[model samples]
Target: MRIYLPTTLALLAEQHAAGAVLVPDGAVVAEDDSEDAEYAALMTAADASAVQLAGAGRRVVVVADLAAEPAVGAAVPWREVVAVHADVEDRPAGADPDEDLAWFATQEVPDLF
Candidate 1:
């Protein structure tokens, strides 16, 4: 199953360099549909990363296809879901419920590493 893994840019770079996505804890997945729920899970992951690493650098949501299932400890969405690495810039300025998932410049991504 695919999962949305929220992480900092630095960590992402490290993982990229290492050539793997270890499927860390707190990664989220859609308990229902594949399209919308994945989007919602992605947003949730992005929002969570933002909160955890505010001002550290650009946040990243690593969409990965995991072989095994991790513990699911959150509420239900059952919303449609998909796989995509959403940046802070993907979110519009002053958007709805998840404003924290707003976008940031990709240029700064290098510096974060």
Candidate 2:
């Protein structure tokens, strides 16, 4: 299953680290374009195209700003869309650090001599 992460640099990095593809949103597309016409056209088409691309059974993770929620809501099917709040931290603090240490311990024997 492929996950499509929207254009938030931090989230994109995090998702990519977690092995997901970074999908650019309308705003990102618009910002990338130099010509006004091209920007407008892409902005208009982005949501629809994104939704179409994220058809049934595909896992789409949309990391859009709060303002973009309404636009995303209209285009993407709710069931397939996982909307992550932009303000929310990518990885919340207090994640299980002990689990990581335990896993590392198994990889190499401790020097108990």
Candidate 3:
């Protein structure tokens, strides 16, 4: 099962800390017609590409800002696409780090097969 993590650098770092393997190093382009048209175009292209790739039994996991845009939960014929919301404040400073680490150690990311 291949996991696709489309997120920002900061969140990618957090995912790494959480032991998410094979996380692609990239940013999730936000859609904006006026301020970020280029980014929007890039996102559209990425989404289309993902849709195609998903058909080949690859698991696509989109990690985006949930508050910004909720990922479309549509039915796909040959793939399992899961979206995980990136929580900026899920980890607090000066907190018991091991406690938070324990959660991810037992958490299931999902199985594509």
17-79 per-residue lDDT for model 3 (tens digits): 555423243334444435456345344434433343433322123432222322333212222
Tens-place lDDT per residue, model 2, 1-113, is 21223333343335434543334443332333346653343334333333434432111124222223233223333233333312222223333212111111211211110
Error of 2 at 77 (Å): 19
lDDT of 2 at 26: 38
lDDT of 1 by residue, 44-64 (tens): 887776665655445577665
How many clashes in each candidate?
A: 16, 0, 0
Candidate 3, after superposition: displacement of residue 67 in Å? Answer: 11
Lowest summed-lDDT stretch of 10 residues in model 1?
74-83
RMSD of 2: 17.0
The C-alpha RMSD in Å for every predicted model, in order, reads: 7.9, 17.0, 15.6
Each model's C-alpha lDDT?
A: 0.56, 0.31, 0.33
